[model samples]
Target: MSTARVWAPRPATVAVQIDGVRHPMTPGEGGWWEGPDLPPGARYGFLLDDDPTPRPDPRGRRLPDGVHGLSQAALPRLAPLDWPGRELRDGVIYELHVGTFTPEGTLDAAVARLGHLVDLGIDFVELLPVNAFNGTHNWGYDGVAWFAVHEAYGGPDAYAGFVAACHARGLGVIQDVVYNHLGPSGNYLPLYGPYLRDQAANTWGQEVELSHAEVRRYILDNARMWFEEYGVDGLRLDAVHALRDTSDEHILRTLSRETDDLSRRLERPLTLIAESDLNDPVMFRPRHEGGHGLTAQWSDDYHHAAHVALTGETAGYYADFEPLTALGRVATRGFFHAGTWSTFRERTHGVPLDDDVEAWRLVTCLQNHDQIGNRAAGDRLSASLSPRRQAIGAVLAVLTPSTPMLFMGEEWGASTPWQFFTSHPEPDLGRATAEGRFAEFEKMGWNRDVVPDPQDPATFQRSKLAWDELAHEPHRRLLAQYRDLIALRSREPDLRSPRLGDLSAEIDEHERHVTFVRGRIRIRLNLGDATWRPEGEEEALFATSDDVSGNPLMLPPDSALVSRTIE
Candidate 1:
């Protein structure tokens, strides 16, 4: 018999409603209530004591209707994943939002574009959140139903197909999941039990009740669902620092251990990458060594330093990273702010990464969703910088020791802005979101007038990548440069070497020039107006501009060249 169970101890009595029929549930141990089992395709909800309203299952796998509507039981599980799993090694990741990656904004439509990613030589296709939320369209951070795939994105089957499609194309899929906090709307967990801490709140909203055993299990189960059912290669844990746990054994440690166990049983690499603001190397350290044992973590310091060096915009958190030396330090040491004073936070921040740690454990990017979408105008570097300057950023991103990631359309230098957009059905929530967006950038001296209203449909449309732009002049040229750089990265052994100690950078602040030495290969970039010649006897492997040729080597302004020693 299929047993329908829910952990809702707060209600003295509970009932399971199926297709308009209410069946009484018997209370069980561990604050659980059980009733008759639900068959496939059954639309069900849990009815608490005295309240006529029915609440969707906290672990519901399907939500055909919106978040507020009844939960529909999912179809029978699909056949076992037929292919051998892949690993995250010296490879590139391409991050894209499913809603804006294509015009159709569905998983099937995204499948059609897998060939482009394969052509670009990306190893993993990292997707933004696809979970169910209240509205029609969003950035996917406002996801309320963690278990259900957003219906607008073609639901569970579509999600499964997308992962399988990526695998068929020799690409691993990394699904970004948020476990720190729930969204602002359609959250009904509190009505069933103490699923959320009352007084505790993070920047997003009420924090998950990590201290509660059942609540912790709820999260672990959700993670397992993605691995076992959806067959994703890895998970990108969003804002993991926000998950505050005072327990002796942290949830992350528990997750790491369990995931490792599953990895062994499945005989495949199950990667867990965290996006943490903590800048702590412990996240990727081995658990036996008193660390969390994640596969990798996003190194925002690299992005900040690279952005500042390329753009010379030192507003907000970019203040400390204004110097070109910042880029050199980050490229060599893996973290620029390791135990350094932060003028923005008004305090010293970050512990230095151990020299033994591999550089590939830290993912570096020139542009990503947060760095672009958080801006007041949602402008990309392509929107402002010359194509040659943008090419230097690409050289830094791909040729560095660390694992690299590229945002959608960044390779082609698409001019479309990836603005902050949402479709909150509640009018008050929509207004609050728009006002909050303005307030966030105001401190950075950004013009609030140019910031598009997040509630506007036009904002979301504006963010879609114009695939046609790939055929144009600067766009086509930039795309070719990216392809060559990525191909060169894969072809060269030294580029994939992860030893942080072996990496070195030379920066001339006055000349606006930087040279990165990876083993015997040297990458020279000229960000200044005047052409600069660096003494070197090497063969040019690739150059962003034809002007990068000479006896010694003359790199044009805002141009870059990759060369190797003749030895």
Candidate 2:
């Protein structure tokens, strides 16, 4: 016999609809409803008030049919894993969507591709959120059930199998989790306790109630459950800036302390990486320092500066960063807007990283999900830049002082676009997304008619990785270069050092040339239309283009050259 409990704070009466029969539930204190002697495979949904529609359990452990049908109490086959001893800062990470990572579009299939990643020299595999969303296909941000792995991705058992496989291969698995808000469809959290804030709002609708004690407990408990039960090495917190909690002790701090305690008990490394737009150094500072003790956070300034410098497209946030000097600042200081004015916000923002903080506290990337997918056409760097330039970007990313991360297929410079796509079963949800997407682009002066409907099936299919591209000539060369660069980063002492002062960047804005110096290694790039010859004596190490020659080096347009300074 199994028992089920759900929190319906506002409901006057709650009943469990099981096999065409309604079983009245006992309402416990604090708006919780409980039922005893329920079967494991029982088909039950909560009936609130006079409403005809039955809602799935808000804290459903398993969703058998996507997010629309029965909530099963089915026990997961594999027990939660015990985390292996490993530090996130010590390894390179490769982020991928399980559905698009392989042709099979399942966790088991993704396991088959782990050898390829291991061969590529990546230490951690950061998966997009696997939580149950509204449909069969999505970017995974619109997650409804935070606990249950999506049924489309082989359910809870398959997820355990995938994690176990990764551990066996000596690779750490990082799961992306969404705590800011839930999706529109199948979002029964509001019907429950104070899971959502009726007063507060985020860019994506209602915000999670982190200030409330019970709500705070729920969120913290969920985070700990994944680490303690699932053996997850680390969590990539999605859009942390949107998590509004005015409590004296922020929820992030609480999570950091809990995770730290768990890590000590398990005798393994556990990390928390936050996806934050706020460039506040407090996120990386230790809890004892009167700051939130997150391990690392995404550095958008690095991407914005690097992208604008390479692509020369200064639209949107790129407007704030047109010159190479901004990129230089990020290279040396770890933040471009360090107490400086932000042109985008028209306000002073971001605190500079403390002198004691290492560069690994920041994670930099050229093409992340938001950077690539939010584009009007989802065009990747390969779509805009030539193969040589793409290689240059990769070298710059890996050689930087901060920890580097690569999106799937970016190593080979795959030409396929990863556009925003979803397969919401509800017609209302589909329509809402279509209208909302167009409206968003309209503010940026984009043609609304030209924007592809995210609800379209073709949109999702187009985002899948083209595994065949890996075998192609140009792609193969780029892939080899990436492996070599990662290998070099791992072997070179100076490259792995996260010291901020050990890095410097020399830039000629008019010539469109930038040279980054990290210890004995100096990497120079010609972003202009003309080739440049080096002034001092330097031995050539690597060049994206083959045009450079002689002791005084010459770099071709949209190319990069790396050399070691001769004494």
Candidate 3:
């Protein structure tokens, strides 16, 4: 028997369409409606009193047709996950969008590529959002049905298979989930209740109401479903700053605590990684330290500093990262805006980073989904920077104490652009999206005419990874360099130490060189045209240029070298 239920307090009467038959539902005490049980494998939709329109379930687990279609009872329960007890910090992370990770563009196809990641030395695989959206192709961020697995990605079963496949290959899975807002099209939350606060305005569609009890439960339940039902190892919370609430206990802390309790129950590490723009260390600080106790968060300061030093782009977010001293600041301290003046915001931006926070709690990446995908054409750093500079970026991101993330195809220096693409069927939404894409790039000085139409099939086709390029020339060399660096990171002790306070940096502004001293290793990079030499008897572990070897280390232009002190 299949039971159909829904929460609809605003409607005078509610009925559920089960197997094409509309059955009346009785209103219960908790603002819920209970209908008669239907046969198993039944597909259903809700009818709110004389209203003729069919509505999808608010807590629907599976959307087989599309977001607009009837919600169905998902088949056979997922088998228990055979976790290998691998933690998120055990090794490095690889972030990929399932749609573009393979030519097939499905979750199972992504599973077929796990062996490649395992060979590339990835311990965790972070997937972009897989929630059901109103399209055939998307980066998956603009999802409407929070509980549904995208039908294009093979729905709920395929996601489970993807997770199991990762675990089978000794990989932990982390999913990106947007708790801040839902996508504009096919949004059903507002139909049931006051899901959005009328007073609150967010650029990313309607903001969810935190004051409502059931709405909070809706999100928290979604969080639990990923771990409990789908067997995802961790969650990467998307754009947490947009979640507005004034409750005594913050939602983030509450989620962290709930995740911890679930972790204990599951006997595995279930964690939360926040994509916070706040730049506050309190996101990952200990609860005893008056923090929210989230496991970790992404830090963009490192990327900003590295981008300025490597690409020399002084536009957009790269404006404040002048003099290249900003890189020096982030290497020693976790944040360049650590209680300092920001030329971008025209005032102080970040709170003072506490002394004791572990550097690894902050995840740093040279290329991430947003960093590349949100660009006018998703051109990677490898597209513009020299091969030598690409190697340098790799060394800094991975060798640093902080946890590092590798975007898909980053290992072989992929040449494909990960441009934003969508297949919204509606003419109005499609037009609006294309216009918005063009308008967004105008501020960055991008050519609006050249901006690919997101609704175009060619746009999605162009973003697929080019696996054939990995065997030739510079791509092969870059792949080798990445493999060696990952091996070295495991072989070295100081580089893996998470204590942020112990690391220090010395920058030579005139010569354009920065030497970082952490643990027993010293990482020196020469960004100038003149060759720079190391002062002492240090052993070279990795060098981007051939000249940065031998007794007197004469580093070449755009070179990065890591050396250990001869004690």
Candidate 4:
């Protein structure tokens, strides 16, 4: 037997409909309603205030049908996992979208590929948002039911199995979650209470009403559910800067404090990584230091600088990152824009990371969902660069002084594009999304004509990774290079060191070569048209090219090498 509880503040009446049988719910304290006990797996929904149509539970654990359909009773709890656990520091992350990672695009199907990640030396597998969204396929961001797993991805049971499988293979899972705004469709929270702010809004529709006590609890509880119930190691908080809250204590601070308490109780390291555009170091600072105290935060500066240095595409936000020194600055310093001028926002942006802060606290990537998907044609860096250049990009990404994350197929340079795709069932909403995507790309200097119609089913299908590419020529070679670098990182204690003070780089602007030192190791990237032959006796540990062998090393243009000085 289970008790039904829902928070609907201003509703004159509230009722619970279990298995099509209506039962009047008694109004309780804190604007909550309680209903009679019911058996598990019962189909249920809430009916409020003279409205004949029932709304899905705001805290539903399962939605077998769809986001708009009746919610199923919580699935039976799985046996506790025997996870040995992994921590965030000095770890590598691989980010993937559930719908496109595999052909089946289900959690069960995704499990079949865990061995590949384990083999590739991935420490954490970061999945894009998987909460219940409208229709069959989406980017997973247009989720309305935050509590329920998307039924298309094999529901809650499959989610549990996927997490268990990862732990079994010694991998940690980081789930991306959105709390700033609900999707355009299937959002019934407004009918129940002030879930969204009335006037204020972010880039995505209305801002969540964090001012309300219950609403704050709702967001906090959802975050904890991933760690406590789902057994995830971490949560990649999506767009935390957009979470506008003017309360005495911000929800992020409260979440940090609560998560710390929960982490102690669970006896495992539970990480909170924020994807923030603010470039604020406060997100990862300890609460005692008057900061949010999150485990880490994504830094886009490295991605932008690396992209500009490699591709020479300085359009839009890449304008300020044009100089090769930008890459060097990010290599040594945590952020390239720390208290610097921004050509994109037309204002000084980002605070410098504190001296005491560890470099590993900033998670950076060369290619990610947003960087690749947001492109006009959803083209990847591999679409333009040669195999050698791709290797250089990998070297810069993996060997950087911070925690590094690789996008879905980035290791082998998967040719498939990760375009923005959605399946909003409402015709009007679909049309609006497609149009808005085109406009946004056009404003960012992208070719408007190349932007795919996000509503088209073909768009979703085209974005899927072609796993067969792994067995082929250049793909196999690049994959090996990535594996070698990861292995080297794991073997070298200096590579895993978190001190930013140990970092220094020599940038040859004309030669287009940059060498960064960490302990006794020297990593050099030759980005020019001519090869570099430095006069030195060094033990060559790893090089992108095979020709860079023996005492006098030859660094090929558009390739990188790692070596230690002969003492």
**Per-model C-alpha lDDT, please?**
0.89, 0.84, 0.84, 0.90
For candidate 2, the per-residue lDDT at 365 reads 86
Candidate 4's error at 393, in angstroms?
0.9
Error of 1 at 519 (Å): 0.7
Inter-residue clash pairs, candidate 2 = none
Task: Please identify model 4 stretches exceeding 4 Å from their true place.
Answer: 75-81, 444-447
Give the backbone clash total of model 2: 0
* Per-residue C-alpha lDDT of model 3 across residues 114-175, encoded as one tens digit per residue: 88888778888999999999989898878999999999999888888888888888888899
**What lDDT tens digits, residue by residue, belong to model 1 across residues 159-178?**
99899889889999899999
Give the lDDT of residue 299 in candidate 1: 96
lDDT of candidate 4?
0.90
In Å, residue 403's CA in model 4 sits off its true spot by 0.6
lDDT of 4 by residue, 445-505 (tens): 7787789999899999999999999999899999999999999999998888557777888
lDDT digits (tens) for residues 1-567 of candidate 2: 557687778889988887667888999987778976567677777888887777787666788976877777654332344445469775898999988888778999999999999999999899999999988898999898888899989988798888888888889888999999988887777776677878778888798888777777777777876776677788999999998878999989999998899888877889899999899988978999998999999899999998998788998789889988998889888999989899999999999776677899899988888899999888899988878788888887777778899999999999889999988778987998989899999888999877878999888888889999999979999999888888888987767756786778899999988988878878788888887877777887766756765368778788777677788
**Colliding residue pairs in candidate 1:** none
All candidates' TM-scores? 0.98, 0.94, 0.97, 0.98
Alpha-carbon deviation at 227 in model 1, angstroms: 0.6
Q: What is the lDDT of residue 26 in candidate 4?
A: 96
